[model samples]
Target: MAGTFYRVQCADCENEQVVFGKASTTVSCAVCGTTLARPTGGNASIEHEIVETVESR
Candidate 1:
């Protein structure tokens, strides 16, 4: 299966980050150190709002 990338904005600090859609571990914000997404076996459980779907090259 191919992996997907997401552009998410942090709820606490308004920081933007790119995360893997099928992440195996919890993802955090780089600026604020807040929880952004958690692994959910399939797609990651995102805590922040998804700004856009990033296209991989």
Candidate 2:
């Protein structure tokens, strides 16, 4: 089984950090020294796909 992970960004330093471990936990950023909110489950991958929709008026 794979460990859980989360995507968190620093509020002060504007840094992106990823936490890989257990669920319902918190992780800290290594760069700006800030704590971030981690997800409940899944891999440590933060990459997400964006879908854009255009509507004609």
Instruction: Tell me, by lDDT, which candidate is best.
Output: 1
Q: What tens digits encode model 2's per-residue C-alpha lDDT throughout 16-41? A: 65555443554556786555544546
- Error at 24, model 1, angstroms: 0.5
lDDT over C-alpha atoms for residue 54 of model 1: 98
Error in Å for residue 40 of model 2 = 12
Q: What TM-score would each prediction reach against the true structure?
A: 0.90, 0.42
* Collision pairs in model 1: none
For model 1, residues 1-57, the per-residue Cα lDDT tens digits are: 688899999999898999999899999899999999999998899988999999653
Point out where model 1 deviates above 4 Å. Answer: none
Query: So what's the TM-score on candidate 2?
Result: 0.42
Q: After superposition on all CA atoms, how large is the RMSD of candidate 2?
A: 10.3
| lDDT of the structure predicted as candidate 2 | 0.46
Candidate 1 C-alpha error for residue 28, in Å: 0.5
